[model samples]
Target: MAKRRTTPKELPDAVREAVDRTVQATRGSAVQTRERAQGAVDDLVDTVDDLVKGAEGRIVRGRRAAARAIDDVRPATNEDMRELKAELRRIGRRLEAIEERLPAKRPPTTRQGAKSGSGSAKPRAARSGSSAKPRSAKRGSSAG
Candidate 1:
């Protein structure tokens, strides 16, 4: 007896059509997802651009305000400084005039020994322990 070869089976038409539909649906979903993602990225980019422009505008405004503030303050501060300098100079001149009018400082007075032509005064001796003499109540009678 000779052996026979068997042929491979093909999928049914309905099953093949179902698989084809599923593939087409998946491809459509992928394209839609890509388009949505691109739109979100563009929107994000636009939002960032708006934020940057807003920040730039605020910075410009702030800089202008600061410049205006400095301008407003500069003259007043300069005038105040000038007045302070003038006042200081006037005070210095007044002090100089007072100093010139004041009496000159005198030399310190000499010690008694130096004035009397004596040698340096000697220190007193320490007293010995002794019974003190009684004091009289009437001062003039004691002196007499």
Candidate 2:
């Protein structure tokens, strides 16, 4: 008893319809899988974008904090030095203006002419003639 094999050209109508239905179902399933995969990829891209933005924000904040910490420990910035120099120049200009407005200083003068001979002048003690010691000398002697 040999078994008979069916040829494609001689296939039953029901079997052919079943095959077509399976192929259509497979195509539909493949299209759904592709759509789901594309959606997953889009979601992953959006999540990555959000993570990158968050990381960038954190980096910026960290840099700012580091700069502030450095500023706190530093003696002065260039801007501060420039301000100090400007203030010093302003003070110097003000001092010069004040000096210009003031009267000139002159050497002290005596009643007699400066050219008078030293021999003609009497000693201060002899002119005053009072023999009492100066207050400062008396105080020094008493303290000693």
Candidate 3:
């Protein structure tokens, strides 16, 4: 029985072929891994987008509900204030028109140092000659 021996040139060629086969397998595996990673990243992005949309919807609904609650608690609306203001303006105009049609009366005048025939009663403080301040002066001093 004769055993076949490998030549020197054949050994190097076999090693090169094995290395090439390993590189090709590694490249194929790398491409598959990259594709799977990209798919996972796309799914994550989609899920995040859906979550953001849901959150936005909830926020809008909450804002609308808050506005409704505020409206329920408020005393009057903008429209009501506008109507009241318009009614007041109409009444003021009517009063002015009525005043223009009526006759004007002169205010009564009193002569200085002339005693009128009206009530001659004096205040108790003035009759007693007390040094206490008058009610009007006290009110004026306190208000300031």
Worst 10 residues of 2 by lDDT: 111-120
Query: Per-residue lDDT of 1-144 in model 3, one digit per residue for the tens?
Result: 899976888898899999999999999999999999999999999999999999999999999999999989989879989999999979967876887798975655667887876634665567788998754576578743
Residue-level lDDT of model 2, residues 89-114, one tens digit each, is 79967876887799986754576666
- What pairs collide in candidate 3? none
Q: Which runs of model 3 end up more than 4 angstroms from their true locations?
A: 1-7, 77-144
Best by TM-score: 2
- Poorly placed runs, candidate 1 (over 4 Å): 1-11, 75-144
Better of 1 and 2 by lDDT: 2
> Of the candidates shown, which would achieve the greatest lDDT relative to the real structure?
3
Instruction: Encode model 1's per-residue lDDT on 1-144: one tens digit a residue.
Output: 898866445546677899999999999999999999999999999999999999999999999999999988876677888999999979967876887799986764666556574533432232444444422333345543
Predict model 1's lDDT versus the native. 0.77
User: What is the descending TM-score order?
Assistant: 2, 3, 1
Instruction: Give the TM-score (vs. native) of candidate 1.
Output: 0.43
Error of 2 at 103 (Å): 19
